[model samples]
Target: MTKMKNESNLKVTFCKRKSGLFKKFSELITLCGAEILLLVFSPTKRVFSYGHPSVDEIVGPLFGYPVRRVEKLMEVEEQHGKKINHDKKVGQDQRWWERSNKEMSYQQLEHLKMSLLNLNAIVTQKMLEFSNP
Candidate 1:
């Protein structure tokens, strides 16, 4: 099993493994002409999903999904576009140091280093507990 030292490391590993899994899933579907629907929930309760052809195509009808009209679909798309734009602007507005560690003061860097080490110890203990149980 892959081990994570801290929350940051865990998150990074999750993203990398998630992307790799999705790529493999895509290859499997393409090579075998298979339908695939995958849903994963992170330890933090966030979701990641991948579906071949379309998510709706595989899971919608079975659940008696509603067929949305063009107007409703368009509205949803507009809202999603707005959300994306807002997130982009927020990211762009963050201070340089907030986005990177290069500008951190010595004290700040030391604090962060200690915090990461503490987190690593906590996570390691939790993993041991889970494994023993």
Candidate 2:
């Protein structure tokens, strides 16, 4: 791709592209429970980032470790895809909340937290309505 010479055009493109990058990362992280640290700098040097849980949580492990992009991670995930789907199908057969917390993966636990929070809000709203009515 050629460098965008127009300053306004460059900034607009950067803004749009960074949003798309973060959206894809959000979807991928939600799908596979993959931890990613994406640090993006805009044309004006403003920082943009998105991290599941938190950026510190993902970055903390890198202190002693060397940074190596593992191609094997993709291959391993590809092989596990079918097994993961099968497991999820079986899991769906059982009532979801009935499953033990210890058996849940990180993403599952995050989902459970969000679900519980939403339930809490609904319960609180109902309680207020009932009391007022």
Candidate 3:
């Protein structure tokens, strides 16, 4: 009976801590003008989540775990801006590979290089089609 009671208390403590962390995350987002989405699964496989704007919209992408779509869209806009201001491209946004180099291990660097090569191949194929047409 004592062991069962201790287990129940531990579960309650876990729930409270999770709720507190989510509340703090919400406050930070509000104060800093940021968007955040979080998903958590308990040991029992129950789900808890929080998202600024709406939980429904962010749900699909968090589950999929790609580089959040909104962030990618912003990067596209920044790249367009840089293209237009090619002569004065100071302080332009950095690509993912550029930003990642600071802390990347050697293995990660090699992987990133391979991914960049793949991206170049895809882009070159599209460019070839444009040129031929």
For all candidates in order, the CA lDDT equals 0.58, 0.57, 0.55
- What is the TM-score of each predicted model, taking all chains together? 0.49, 0.46, 0.39
Error of 1 at 40 (Å): 1.3
Comparing 1 and 3 on TM-score, the stronger one:
1
TM-score, prediction 3 = 0.39
lDDT for each residue of candidate 3 in 6-123, tens digit (9 for 90 to 100):
6677688778778678778878987996777666656565555556754434543544433354455435545654544463337944343334357654644665555434434433
Report the alpha-carbon TM-score of model 2 versus the true structure.
Answer: 0.46
In candidate 2, what residue range of length 10 has the lowest lDDT sum? 64-73
lDDT string, candidate 1, 25-96, tens digits: 988998999999787767686555566675545555555444353235435545754554455435454332
- Which candidate model has the greater TM-score, 1 or 2? 1
Ranking by lDDT: 1, 2, 3
